[model samples]
Target chain A: MADTSHGAAPGAESAPGMPQLDFSTFPNQIFWLVVTLVILYLILSRVALPRIATVLAERQGAIQRDLDKAEELKRTAQDAEDAYNKALADARSQASEIVAEAKADIQKDLDKAIAKADAEIAAKAAESEKAIQAIRDSAAKSVAEVAQTATADIVNAVMPNAADAKSIKAAVTARLKG
Target chain B: MATEEAGNGFNIHPMDQFEIKSLFGGGPIEWYSFTNATLWMGFAILAVVLLLVVGTRKRAIVPSRSQSVAEMMYGFIHKMIEDVAGKEGLKFFPYIFTLFIFILVSNFLGLLPTSFTTTSHIAVTAMLAMAVFVAVTVLGFYKNGMKFLGLFWVSSAPLALRPILAVIELISYFVRPVSHSIRLAGNVMAGHAVIKVFAGFAGALGVWAALPILSITAVYGLEVLVAGIQAYVFTILTCVYLNDALHPSH
Candidate 1:
């Protein structure tokens, strides 16, 4: 190390008016300080600053991208919620319509069955009336024939206006007795 | 209190006397002579160089103990700069950290027996301080241009107070190196002188004097603390000056 002894550092020591500026003496100290400063400035402005700025920029950009993705996911979730609600509404209306349709179909089927039963009953009643009418006519004709015969017999026997109604009377009595 | 009493009583050199010397060579090139203070500076530089060289040689994500210790120191200083001066202002971190480490190492190294205290010498401290002063002034103007001189006369002054304020500001600004250098040198020199005096007292104690030794031990601890603090103050002040340069209105 270079001796800086005779030039004792002035502070609490050293007399006033001693030469303060001696470039010839402390050249190396000054030189080293300058070198340090220049090198530090270069490193800061060039190498370190650029790398740090880039890292920070990339970090911020990544954050922004993530935010965009999150926003998109949120929108998709909102859409899904809306669709779910809409589907639920559709299901509710469809269920009620289906219930109403079933009721209407049942009513239609009942009306049709009632109409068919009425037509069948009317046809069967008309056939029964016709059979009863034919039976009544046959019964009336038989009664009339019996009365006519009886009257004829009575006339012939009693008046005897012609050859013996006695034979006819006997026939009638026999008929009656047998 | 005990340490102070011991320190006050013992004196290798009279407390009132201040002596400065340059040993080994003399004459025209006397400034090139080897010095006790320069030895301290050398020790400081050696510590910094060794630390950086060994610390960085085996860089790892999950660091080994030595590397981690180095990283912790780096991180600590980095955070200090970022916290005090913005990350935008962090362009000055390396220099700030270097200044701090060098000063701190020098102060601590000086505490050893048969060692020198470089910062106690005004020329060394003054040179460091002058460099900071020059850098601050130049950087203020360079970064902000001629308008940077407004740091003295502008901002919070009333129109009438401008001249007076300018005078005061100039005086204060010029005094920056003086106060900075004086504060460091004075503290170290005064503390070392006190410790030497107390150490002498310990030797004078007779067979029945265990108390002086204990007090000497206590002064040693306090001196260690002061050494670290003085270095810290010097470094932080440098950063503060840099901050003012970066943001002159501040």
Candidate 2:
């Protein structure tokens, strides 16, 4: 009676090595196992997995969005660079055109100046030649008249002879003719 | 969780220690106590739930530290599901994730001092294993309906050996739960018992006890690792089970 109350107490020896299998205690554990599994399933199906999946998809979407933004920025940068290059090209062409135009205009103005100077030089030279010839003739005539008058006056005073004066006049006429 | 003289008349038994109980049908069954093991499972599950929930509550655009951790866990599961269950079979993700978490929690819980490891109980493990069994069988039915019956018959086997193969398959199917449950429960139960026995030395040796402490500490660390590893084993087995269900030809 005492051994029975204690359960596995005295005189309960089995064959020394082998352990006995007890078939009686599984009902409650099995019951709870099902219960817990069912409850866990509910929690997972309803809550955890769905939320986890949502977060995962959100992260995927975030990464995707960032990549898309990066691509867009890259495209935009490329476009900006292209536009800048084109603008620079345009500016360079425009500057070249302006420089060419300036060169042509200057060349035209320079040719016109050269032509005007040539015409002015030609006119001046023609006028100067005629004036120089007239001045030379007039000065020569004035010199001859002054010389004749002085010579006549000197001869008349010194010789006081018509013959002397005639001789002087004849000599002057001969020198002049020579 | 106290049983008051359990049952009356033919079914009467004491509540102090673990015992086996018979099920509705005629077969042997055992009942286990929650004493240390069950307590551990509770704490571990609470820890897991708290981690995922509290860790992932805030959704930041550029995720906070917790969010990233949550995201990593989510990604791992997603990939595992995709790889093991395949893309189309991901509908079972919830069940798989739950199994993983619960087992993981239970295993980890078993490692703690003064905690009951529910997973160490064969009855509990058998129930989990049975769930997988039922789920896979149901999945087979769902995917193929009547055609899934072909899973039992090895048409490729020699005609002479076909009957033997069918019997083999049936027995193997019945054995699945046993193997599944025993693998987990045995590892945990044995591990903890060893630890406890080793820890018994410190009391026996008394006062002069550097050796026992060092030994117990080693066992403790090993148990901790085993806790995590056993959880992983359970999870992977679940995957393989899911795989078997999803693709019945194997």
Q: Which runs of model 2 end up more than 4 angstroms from their true locations?
A: A1-25, A127-178, B1-41, B62-67, B152-170, B204-208
Could you tell me the interface RMSD of model 1?
7.9
For candidate 1 chain B, which ten residues in a row score worst on lDDT? Answer: B13-22
Q: Which candidate has the top score in lDDT?
A: 2
Each prediction's TM-score versus the true structure? 0.56, 0.72
Alpha-carbon deviation at A83 in model 1, angstroms? 24
The 0-to-1 C-alpha lDDT of every candidate, in the order given, reads: 0.65, 0.68
Q: Which candidate is the best by TM-score?
A: 2
CA displacement after TM-score superposition, residue A76 of candidate 2 (Å)? 2.7
Q: For candidate 2, write residues B98-168 as lDDT tens digits.
A: 77778777777656676557777776777788888888888888887877767778888998898899899
Q: Candidate 1 — which residues are off by over 4 angstroms?
A: A1-178, B1-11, B14-29
Q: RMSD in Å for candidate 1, one decimal?
A: 10.3
lDDT score, candidate 1, position A122: 92
What lDDT tens digits, residue by residue, belong to model 2 across residues A1-178? 2322344434543211111122233555665566566766776677665676677678779999999999999999999999999999999999999999999999999999999999999999999999999999898778776777788888777777654556666777677778
What TM-score describes the B chain of model 2?
0.77
lDDT of 1 by residue, B22-128 (tens): 44564333444553434456566666555554544444444566555555565666677777666756777766766666667777887887676656666667888
RMSD of 2: 8.5
